[model samples]
Target: MLSVNSVLVPAEANVEVTFTSNMLVVYIDRHSKQVCLLPLDEKRQRKPKPYPFKVIAGLVEAEAVIKAQLDIPTYHLLEDSSFTTSRIVKRNERYQIISPIISEIHRYMFPRYGRSIVAQVAQKTGMQPTAIVRLMNMWFYGGQTINALLGDYSQVGITSPGKNARKVGAKRKNSPFVGRAITEQDIAKIRRFLNKYVLTRKIEEQMTLQGAYDEMLDLEYSTLLVAANGRKKVVAWSDDDIPSYSQFYYHARKYFDEQKKYPRQFQVTAAAYQKDHAGRTATIERINRPGELFQIDETPFDVVLVANRFSITGLCVGSPTLYLVYDVHSNLVVGIHLTLNPPSWEGMRQALLNAFLPKVSFVSGME
Candidate 1:
């Protein structure tokens, strides 16, 4: 561990000690969250020494100079927020330049000494000097020190393509069961077992994947013991022929895949989930006038009606369907019609007439 005084050198000091000139300078590539530690020349440019960096987790045992610069404790670099507070990592390979291009900036004494340093380094590296200068000044400032160059690895590997990018996990392999000797018949049996015993059951009563596997093993044993009347005797196989739990579970999972469009499990139990959880959107139209837009729909009332008021025999029991019409702008009920049967053309026509006709003593005989 370095004492605070040895590692904390004054920026204005012109002393040329062996380590001050030969020691590695720690800088953080903010865009990459990379902590680059490379040797610097007397001109404050990068030397052709080996540059090594690790993710935040790897920084716990880093040199005291690096930890002090990054304001991280010796125990764990991750717990410190001074350097990592809000910095995010860019994950695209396009943003990642070769480490040489990045670490070599320490070798060229640029705008600090003179403009010619940038030109000298650029001509040697075959890259535009302007880009080099921009990268160097990106984290460089007077009295900034080496610590300002530490990248924030807390949010490294961010790849979102918008105003606010976010961190994401590395992608998984295509499939874990790729080399297995699974066949169509094995997959079919697994699907049938899931559909019949697992998926069809109520959510509360559904069997777990392990429970289903055990049951299938029991079924396999029973099949070998008992033979059907007309069909050929079931062949008994060695215990080695049986599929492993992981193999069985993998095939069973296909039926319950959540990524499927309009998944059957959700469709069947939609009523149990809240309607708002469905993430549906509704459109509200803008109405300028009372009669500009009209909305019409029909529904059945809860009460049963006796429709044989004038019948000579007896009362006829029936459910009455009610048609409702409303003005969209004013939200007023303009028309209502009641009929013993379900909604029909006649019901619609009567409802329209009720809306258009004037309700007054002069129009008493209109109905």
Candidate 2:
């Protein structure tokens, strides 16, 4: 005996098969006119019954008519041999295992009859009910073929990881608010509003969080509220499409930390940034070599100088101006000029001359 577990057929097509005690079961496709012979089982056969010559002749004639319609040739039949018999036995064994499943499925489609069908199939076939259900579902969805029920394996024939993992809402799409209260779009709007109003605007006018919240609420309601005078009152703000301040602030803070915190802190607290953050004082300069530059300035000496020597007592004198030139790179005194007269442009000219003159020749004494 031979039976079919499942077979792939076209839509609205039927399968025809004729069988008896010891003959092979041949399947004919009603639409395609193709014939498939099922392997026979000697163990399942009763005491060797005589061949049904009439049935065989009718099948042969049907096959010939199908071939004539398709314009294909027919081949000669071979005598029975041990090899053919063994192949039949193996195929029959597999068929017997899968026959009951096919019968149950044919009796009740899986969608119409689910667990009950699986339970009945399990009871009749002695197979795991879930396995039967899974196979049936695969068959219904995957071309209704026995091959669709087979498991995938690696090249080495090992079952792949998670191949048969339980499917618990696995095909569902992810929600934007999976771990949060608000969606990403709402959070983005809050951040953009915060940046435009809170951080980037005038620092002096920036309000605290509570003040901002109150302002937002006022702005929200003000647009909808009409004045009693009804003088064509107009308000530019509306909260009709806006979210709550709490939700807005939560995501606003997140975007703020990522975009604004560090830069804003630097700008707000940069009073002594050059000396503190930059690690350099205002008076310091980086010089590499000596005698690169010079500095010149004039100032009155603290001590008074003698102006007249003709008097018995030295006349009290005013302080004389002293001009000094120093090298900025080496910190050395490059030139000096002294005179009793108050400072003038000529005094500066002489100071410049003194800087270029020989040190030994350019001598000066206090008067």
Candidate 3:
């Protein structure tokens, strides 16, 4: 399956390439079978061009290795730098501009990035051919994601304090209140609230980010008000006085990064880890023989059984527990034990005996 962002590297020393579209598969035709691809080269190319599907598929089947398959999450997760709102918006705008060009190219069976295609796309999108070509090249090389179009802000210098009086970044849109610069006091409060609420080894005690933010507001940014009716009420501070969720999230991410902890923790019990993770083998690749591994489990049967002699009286008996030992490699149930007794070592021992003993003698004794 060659899909968009699937990287193909040749066995020999050659420039690798990535598929830009799955048009050949979706719109397959006997007369024309080609896919759009871009070469992964240091020097930027003009645009993605079409390659014969038969030729590329043959190469992939024989000698080429699919190096990587990149999706939106994989691309963003692998990025070391964090994305700001402005950067995200800019990337989205660039994607919007190039999406039409991409769609136009995909419409044809075997489209070429020639002057004709470029001119058509330019006329339809009201953009210059050169600009479209540049963005297309950027999108292709950037793992075919909107985030790839984001500008590198790492080298950009921070704005001077003289630019704004109260706030450090852009002002809030469609709002009377403006966000203020984060102060040392605010950072201390954020740390305190996070420690008290967010980060915890106990899953049941963990609080969500929104809950932590709300707690901070109630404790730090709110004041008790006494009305004329003699009733006391808690009044939250103005938006300008309190930090926004984005600010809190940003600081929290920085704190986690400094502590070398993942933003989202996977909490698992010791028993669960031992069962699901510890000494686990890759069954698909490692298990090659029938007796190499056995999966054993005990489960109660769904239906209740009745005593054989008490059927006329309609006497009800409890459901029996069933223990099964499954052979993984051969996908067969090698051993089973059904008992009315509660699950115990006795049932397990009987099941193991049945598995090791000859089947003919066991069946003969049962009959």
Candidate 4:
């Protein structure tokens, strides 16, 4: 880089920085004719190479002395008497006469004399382009662009264009279900099953690449829910059919436990084991209509969440006896409410009336 010692007008300063000997990416304010000195930072350069640099410096000094003999031959030609008969040296031939270019001279001088920029840099630098970038990025507006992307993701919530991508780094997170791949043998089996059942489930023509993936995730997560792999989140597969093994051992137990408690519906319960190929499982149970046979079940749940103590008249009860009226056929809960006191038989009749009477009145109002 060549420096100009002169200063410009009142508010302006011009600095000359030569990028290469020939090429430069110039920065200028044309109005003021001011050349801005861009901010440059040195990020912890590496330690010096002491031994080799010292040795090289010694070698170049030694070579310079011996090369003075070879240069003497060219000197006689310039001396003018007998040498003038041969040829005269011209300004243009000065460059052609010297074999080594300036860049090449720098390369040799650095290794030989410990003075070249590239040699000292290679000893103490990583990727040169990347280092140049890091220095430049700290200057004008690099961090702002990065912060904007992070801020945008926070504002619009995308996890690979999803929820909480910024906060939790969900793009880097492991998939909830990993082994969703359809293997060679598994694909053959799935293809066979697809022909038989895919259309029945309306998945034959409508399934997409991601739909295929989702189906696999559901089947896979269902099957390997238990067999714990060494990873805390990973579930191991001890059997040949990994999905079937995990499902039968882990999920089946839960299904059976659920069925035992609800004995009357056990035979007609939704089968979740469609992919496992063992017993009937309830995965895709088609829900019935909005309201049918009213279910009478009282569940104790916390009401403090929906209604604060001040709104509840400050009764100070932790749990409320919530009378939930659900339709047995449709599985739709018509009403869920908490009355102040413990419910009795008389309260039950009133609860039913309080739950259904509103609907009857609303329909009559519509009529």
Candidate 5:
């Protein structure tokens, strides 16, 4: 059977299309033998149209190669080994952001579901539908894998704030000072401020973007005024005297486009920072044998079971904790244990015993 991410190269020398088999089922009737093929191609539009699977099958039988069936090299294998740790981390982060969206729209990504599925998801998630669609398309075109999401960092060029006599960007509403133009000197000051306050390696010392902007204004543009009564006051600089916050932010992003860690304003928690930076120390080791490594975890199942199912007024029992042991090499579940009690040694022992023992038929009504 055709599976997800199966690349199909037609005999006619047309652009190759990847199959999204999850969406192949006919939505109108469940019993219908007629099914559609959700073929995605880079040159084709994002809209999913129903093409008869029989035609695709014929092409496959003739000469089309299901590339995924063969030992195709993955993104990690093809990626340059020269790439730095920071670049890899950034690519992973980008994938993390797009992963949730991909999962949300996986079944609806095909043409049979229509664009409304994307629109509905966008509305609920507060994301732009166009952006969501673009990401989806990128995933399909890039081999329907996380590696496809890695950005093209090959082109690195400095963007110069072109010399202008007057200020750039929209004027502030109801403000007399029509902002100062961003000069090379202003750009230099912005860089210094960003380095000192916003881009510090130490988390405790780092400042928010807005905080850094305020500090820049106070240090670089503020003036001390002395009145006739010998009273000294600090007068803030006008818009015309200093660069706007927008200008500062724009230059900061342009200059530090390849920043590994986000500033305080963008970071939600310390854990997020650790995930982006500190988490890279451990690399995934290649597993050669199924018995070489076994991973185990426990989670509360969604279902709740009662002490007695036959009684009308059965006490409400909480969800059972499910323990699973899986072979890391082949990703096959080796053992399982279900218990009403929370995670404990008993559950682990049972699961491990199940994994070590020979397989047997599980008959119903057996304790």
Candidate 6:
């Protein structure tokens, strides 16, 4: 039986001696690769999992052996395979916060959804997967409000990247909860419910402006009242989910019956609406004189401009007028006409008459 007096080394040093069994001891140094060991039959039993026990004692013994003879400085044992006490001890926590799905669709996630979801979370807080899973489970269980238990890891902390918002929203999502806005499937589900109950005939065939206003009321009224217009309040939650409007709107009549909180009192009035005349039968000419030369031209146009090319055939009836009046004396065009609507013969005639006004006087000196 080898005792402590026979094998024990000085303080801050290690020495190994065989006593009870064939257990190898290691030791720890101050730096990262630090390992320390003790005999398995140690008086100090290590706390159960992850802490380096036998390997560290073995290292310490090795260090002491070298120190007593060769006297070399002890090296840190952090990188040694013998130091594998915890299997996953060296992995990054940050890598876990951004899940695999985020990395796969980072390019296309923001465009369709509105960029307030995963992108926001990634940009904001360093919450872990367990936390996110817990939050989702909370939502699945009962937290239906979108603003459920938002900590520093939520919307308040991370603002969506505005420049990348489109791509983020457009990214494909397997689940509706992953996105900022409702998906087409959500809309389809609402339609299915509506069809099942024949809601179009009984409730609303087409959503009216008034109904839209009322729906907005039903969505916001309760929340706004609780928040009060001018006051800020702190709302808390443990586990929360989100209430989705896409699914709710199908049965909208159950909540709001066209009673608008924001009333639309539209009064139609006579006012001129501005239209672009760019590339619309442009009149390129120099007027030789007010009455001498008048040019009238028209171009077929389309309402739908695709790939920056407009249709020129009769498929489009919109004719933009290109009328030019030139002064004969200076050969400079004095009048030009362009209109978004179809150019009628009457409009052309009016344009010519306006160009050919009887006593139109140019500044006699400044010509």
Residue range 122-186, candidate 6, lDDT tens digits: 45666643444344322211212222212112233343433212223453455543323334443
Runs in model 5 lying further than 4 Å from the true structure: 1-3, 13-45, 63-75, 78-93, 104-106, 111-114, 124-127, 152-367
Judged by lDDT against the true structure, how good is candidate 4? 0.36
Q: Report the lDDT tens digits of candidate 5 across residue range 29-51.
A: 12332333434434543534444
**Which candidate has the highest TM-score of all?**
3
On a 0 to 100 scale, what is the lDDT of residue 194 in model 6?
A: 37
Which pairs clash inside model 5?
A: 48-111
Comparing 2 and 3 on TM-score, the stronger one: 3
lDDT of 3 by residue, 223-324 (tens): 999999999999998787778888898998898778765433435678988998899667655887779998888997788888889999978888899999
Question: What is the Cα-based TM-score of model 4?
Answer: 0.17
**Cα lDDT, all candidates:** 0.51, 0.49, 0.70, 0.36, 0.65, 0.37
Of the candidates numbered 4 and 5, which has the greater lDDT value? Answer: 5
Q: 334, model 5: CA deviation in Å?
A: 99
Residue 279 in model 5: shift from native, Å? 64
lDDT by residue (141-187, candidate 4, tens digit) is 12211121111112232213221112232332343432222234543
TM-score of 2: 0.26
Number of backbone collisions per candidate:
7, 0, 0, 15, 1, 53
Model 2 Cα lDDT, one tens digit per residue, 265-290: 32545566755676653786767776
Which has the better TM-score: candidate 1, or candidate 2? 2
* Per-residue accuracy of model 1 over 1-367 as CA lDDT, tens digit each: 3221112222234332223433333344445434433333344443222223343323334332243342342322333343344332321121232233444554342224335565666676677765654445333421123332343343444333332222134532653322224456666777776766777777677777777777776775345434456554545443445555777877665556752522233354566555545666799878898889888888977876665664775576778989988988899988878888876888988887888877674257555
Q: Considering lDDT, where higher is better, how would the candidates rank from best to worst?
A: 3, 5, 1, 2, 6, 4
**TM-score-based ranking:** 3, 5, 2, 1, 6, 4
Off by over 4 Å in 1: 1-283, 307-313, 361-367
Assess candidate 2 and give its lDDT: 0.49
Q: Which parts of model 4 have CA positions greater than 4 angstroms off?
A: 1-292, 302-318, 360-367
